[model samples]
Target: MMVFTKYLEDFLMKCSTIGRNSATGRLAIGVGHESYESSHLQPSQWYGEVRELCGLANRPCTFPCTNNLSPSEAAEALNDHIASICQQLPPLDTTRLPAYLPARLIAPTVSQFQVLQKLEKTRVKRGTIPLDLPMHLIKEFAMELATPLTSIINASLQQSKCPSQWKTVFVTAIGKTQSPSSFGELRPIAITPLPSLLCESFATDWAYQDLAPSVDRRHFGNMRSSSTTHCLVSFLDFVLTHLDKRKSSVTSIFIDFKKAFDLVDHITVISKAAASMGIRECLFP
Candidate 1:
């Protein structure tokens, strides 16, 4: 599943279009489901597809809670806070940094990635908020710095025409293993033309919007059809909406019922839902 997710991410980064296709009236496909573990059966379903689901909400939240720390634990808590914030900062490495700053100044300042060069001559210790700094004040500073740093760094490296810049950004932004040659063609999630225009429309009924949930059994035949795009996007949007929400939380539980499909015990789920809707069916052959 990890391999599949990685491959899918790579594929999305490439061949997919980001703008409206006047030729086909379709834009791009939405992909859900991160590859967490491999399974013998496919993960898609009719009412809800499991494969495209994000694992965040079900996983455990690890962020250190303020309620559990002591006076001396403050530093450790601060480190946790810094680590969480650092994970979101733009990539940093020798090739991507300003030509002037020393390598020693990189990591610490990378938490403040946009302004590392600005403070190379000054000493801002890592994990140590200044004495006079209030907690909110430091957070505000980090947020303020994060905006321009991200904008400047992204603007500088996002050009597909420049191989050198793309290579560096590719290695830094996505990961070293990802190929820069194909990186330029990569697309960010849901930023495409069709999806962008219909963002609101799709948000309401993501799964039912375009393709039938059953289409996963085969490749899209009329791949260029507008209906295909809408359906696929809706299916994907459903997954992304859930995943996005999950990503913001900090805990998740991944359970694989020994025979998930065969032993699902769907009778309970079906009966309850159907009963409320005044419908009844065995729904099984």
Candidate 2:
């Protein structure tokens, strides 16, 4: 008994000494979230594993690991690359916009029950995780976490003030080639916080439900039962039908803009989204 207690104390000490900000969740009673086989391993067996994972979250994500950059240097490189991509786009002029009826979007009220449902449905294997926190912990403690999460989400909706952490995302650069030499060659995948992502889904559903009528039926991308292939097939069918009717030569033009999303005026995006939600001036949280 004495030996076991001593070992427990030492184990706690090592886990505490890890550089991670939140170690309590990692030290839970059950096994690590990874695998069932790990459950039978002694603390010493897992100690090295946890230690290996400790500083990994903070590791510099530069391509070609040989660069041997400090975290700050890597971060600076990422910022410079991102800045180069952010071409300033002209803002949309509201003056020329056609007038539309004042339509109010009444989103369904969020409840703890609904939040719990969302939590219960969350799977641990989601590709994206919170920028800093582990998502599995929340999903594991869903019952205990639901109330607080519900309150926070409800408050955010009411005040239209989104937490800064929710808006912040980290980019993970995946190599496109066998040996990625430059940042340009790497595909950047943005990972948003689990909570922020959930909130986004809620907002999307809320806005889509109300704004569905305003959207064009032909605008099929990102909608259910629609794909780029489906759009192309439909266009081809229309062209064939027109030719059967003996119409004149059909003209088709395609334009592809480089870094289109990066060039978008985000202020315009936020203002437009907010106006659609029946709020003016302040952007959606």
Q: Pick the candidate with the highest lDDT.
A: 2
lDDT of each: 0.35, 0.65
What shift in Å separates residue 73 of candidate 2 from its native position after superposition?
3.1
Model 1: per-residue Cα lDDT at residue 57: 23
Tens digit of per-residue lDDT, candidate 2, span 1-285: 456545655775675556235423334333346432234444454554443444222343446843788888987887678767774555456554433324243334588888888877877776765353455776778888878888888778767678987887778777776567877777778878877877777777766665676677888877867899888988998888777775556678888976667778866766665556444232233
Residue 252 displacement (Å), model 1 = 38
lDDT of 1: 0.35
Total residue pair clashes for candidate 2: 0
Clashes of each: 16, 0
Give the poorly placed runs of model 1, Cα more than 4 Å off. Answer: 15-61, 69-285
Q: List TM-scores for all candidates, in order.
A: 0.16, 0.61
Give the Å shift of residue 106 in candidate 1.
28
All models, RMSD in angstroms: 28.3, 15.0
